[model samples]
Target: MQPPLPGPAMILHRRVVLSAALAAPPLAAPTLAQAPAPTEAPRTLPARLLPVPRSVSAELQHRIAAPYPANWDHIPPDTAGWRALQAASAAEVDPLLPGLIEALRITVTPTTIAGVPAFDIAPRDMRPDRQGRLLVHLHGGGYVLYPGRAGAGEAMLMAGFAGFRCLSVDYRMPPDHPFPAALDDAIAAWRAVTAQHDPRRLGLFGSSAGGGLLLATLLRARAEGLPPPAAIAPGTPWCDLAGEGDSVNANAYVDNVLVSRTGWLGAAAALYAAGRDLRDPLLSPVNGDLSGFPPAILTSGTRDLLLSDTVRAHRRLRRAGVVADLQVLEGQSHAQFLDPTVPEAREAFNEIGDFLARYLGT
Candidate 1:
């Protein structure tokens, strides 16, 4: 008297369906208020300076100095005094050559890469897979400092740790040759490398001014429709030749190396720019189009005055959809990546090797 068992049609009919629909509450309709807010573009903030590390090598810590002299950049270019200063600077590092050679365990062979004077630094026991792979190094000295074997330290460490053949470009610099001179020599080296091996098998790397030049050279390569190298490592690059960046001001005297943009660093850029527009993309890769650039690995230290340059370049590369990696060491300063005695420096080179191996298969 449960009324006659519901008939088959009643059990499976529109009535049953309607009853269920009525029993359940209706879903709310989506509206603008319920939708997610659109994501806003990320903005950069001024970075706070970090305290120098207590664990830094005493040798490095001792070398730190008061802010550079106010008159460091006062000398005019191409003058006898300027020439003398450059010479003296070169002389300072000359004694360190033997030690650098020993620490890196590289054999130096004089050679010409693309008609540019360069030195080939080969590791004693390179990995078999890295046999034909090569790295072309541009030394950093603003644009008028380290020259000759004195500039080979970075390349030596790279060759030693990365197990790749390295050619350190001994490109001419200001007072004698400037601007396009360094760029031209870099390109020549690139052409030479490409002639002997596939461009995809090569890597370009440098620090500070040399790092900036590596980026500039890449811009030139793209403009000329040349094949880009497999990867590049620009360590704390002075990418903004115009001297634009928050760290340029924030880290001023805080960074012992390249102490200030208003000092010798500025003068060196002026000598290299030689009256060219600082905003010129060739001089400041930051202002250039980086869309099609090869994968890049950028290294810097928290205390480096050029930390802004490295960060900006990494951000730009990401915005352009290019593959890029940035590694910032705690409490180190400008170009500290070249110090083999520093554990951070050795790790930096290994990180670069891993990046290149992924791209170049060596």
Candidate 2:
């Protein structure tokens, strides 16, 4: 009787604890089917909203910021707390740049280019068998953040593929400089490399702002009666600042990083122009006449905010009777070819090789 009387309180406490435990289940294992697919960011090209192609280097249907991410996984994390992240990412990225360049099997030399100024020239390793073609490259990163080293690695890699020498320019950057500074340096680099060389041996290449500069350089050269390049390849060029493209508004939410809106480019353009109109033909390049520009190969990704820029540029070159080849990748980012680690980038570079091979030779 004493045992039974004492048990009720303890029994009730035990029952209560058991009931609470049963109410919540242990964590379940994720299903095999839930495994994430290898992420492939799609290049954004909303067919319904694509801008009408204009006669001037294809005008953007709308200005876009950066291309957008389709999902949270694809999007970059909060930049607010990512300085360390950015630095670390840059650390990882920087090494690869050099490694890629060194791996190019190029033997750099001091060789003068034709049509370029009487300045220095840096020769990259290229097969003598494919000796005639040359690459004049402009590096990207708005106009402030990057240097010629910015894209030299990509150039070296591409040089191997195209069997051409890269005369990459280490142009002056912002703060100490502005708009025409980079353009001037780029043209000088081109001229320096082309000195004593033939125009038929020349090619022009750039990405992002550098790509836009390639167009501007061509326009300036044509205006000044400089020798024409055999071909031009502007990859994912950012050629506008009036913010007049469909992607600018439509892609606002999806693009994760800097854009035509508040991104780094607007600032770069301002500093580059030293307060000049961003739409100035020398500033935007898209505003320049397409006539007498050399044949071109324009490449862009579906998600690239600059896809419209590439499209517009290609279409304009075509309308002007310039030989233009436009390649649109399914899921690519800006200048994906510059990133050989990415599968899409490798694929893009391979395609670029084919394009350059055809244009430079035939």
Candidate 3:
């Protein structure tokens, strides 16, 4: 004889019992002695297996097949090791810039703003309406990678695609400078840029660690009485360094880049944070008040580990009465939109360009 399957009545009864239990919840706190052991406190979910969807473009599908780079799994043992890894990553990415620059017809020049290193990017054929507008970009590299010319890739892409002048801030990072250093440089650059351009014509943008930094910069700028940008675009922002998002676990092994927080991602956070509290508004802007923030366009993908972070930030901004737009790519993971070869990448930037143009002045 076989066991009986759950009948509709039984299911209804279960739901009724569960609802009654939920409605009756008003238990007092348990004593420490009565509390369950810490290790046994957390409930576990069954393991899952996911497949890459065919909904995205073929190029993106190929990218999804091999999401991470060769060195994505290697954990650096020391500062020297981290530097070597950074150099290797830069070497791989830097060579492709010249071709992209020529194709996009954008000129990238190294410059300093408020004594901080940066790159000024301008398109040859600028949009007449965007002539007076300026965008300040911050590059994403876990707050430690992509230094010098290597960090200007995203700025070039935006300038070429969006027809706007961009200043990519090559902020100082950890292993030498940590915590407040990058934030300080960003603030200084913001102050200098605002001095030259009208704040109403200025926009801010960045991704991953850069996205997180962009939000932190806004919070710090607000506290310091600095004028806000007309708009902002934070793509796949690592908003919570403490890794408190559901996707952090749900998207584990799902996102090709920044594979898991337990790996290099968490290490980078610890390295950049130094000994500072992870909840500091300057470190994790998600915990900060975003009441007076300007209109924002937050981007993420279904498979991105930071999807939760981006969604949470957008919700927070919306709850604070700000006009917040969210764009979720079909199958991207992490900052895959940075890849110019991907069709969706272009579409993502186009959407961002349109969003910024809506708020920016001529």
Compare the candidates by lDDT and give the number of the best one.
Answer: 3
> Comparing candidate 1 with candidate 2, which one achieves the higher TM-score?
1
lDDT of 3 by residue, 177-296 (tens): 898899999999999999888999999999999999999999999989999999999989988999998999988788988788888889899989999999887899999899999999
Model 2 residue 328 CA deviation (Å) reads 1.1
Q: Model 1 over residues 128-203: C-alpha lDDT tens digits? A: 9787788889999888877677777788888888877899999988777889999999998887778778888888
Off by over 4 Å in 2: 1-94, 108-125, 256-260
TM-score preference between candidates 2 and 3, better one: 3
Residue by residue across 230-288, what tens digits does model 2's lDDT show?
77888878787555655655554344434335554454556667888878988887777
What is each predicted model's overall lDDT from 0 to 1?
0.81, 0.62, 0.90
TM-score of each: 0.81, 0.68, 0.90
> How many residue pairs clash in all the candidates, one count each?
0, 27, 0
Clashes of 1: 0
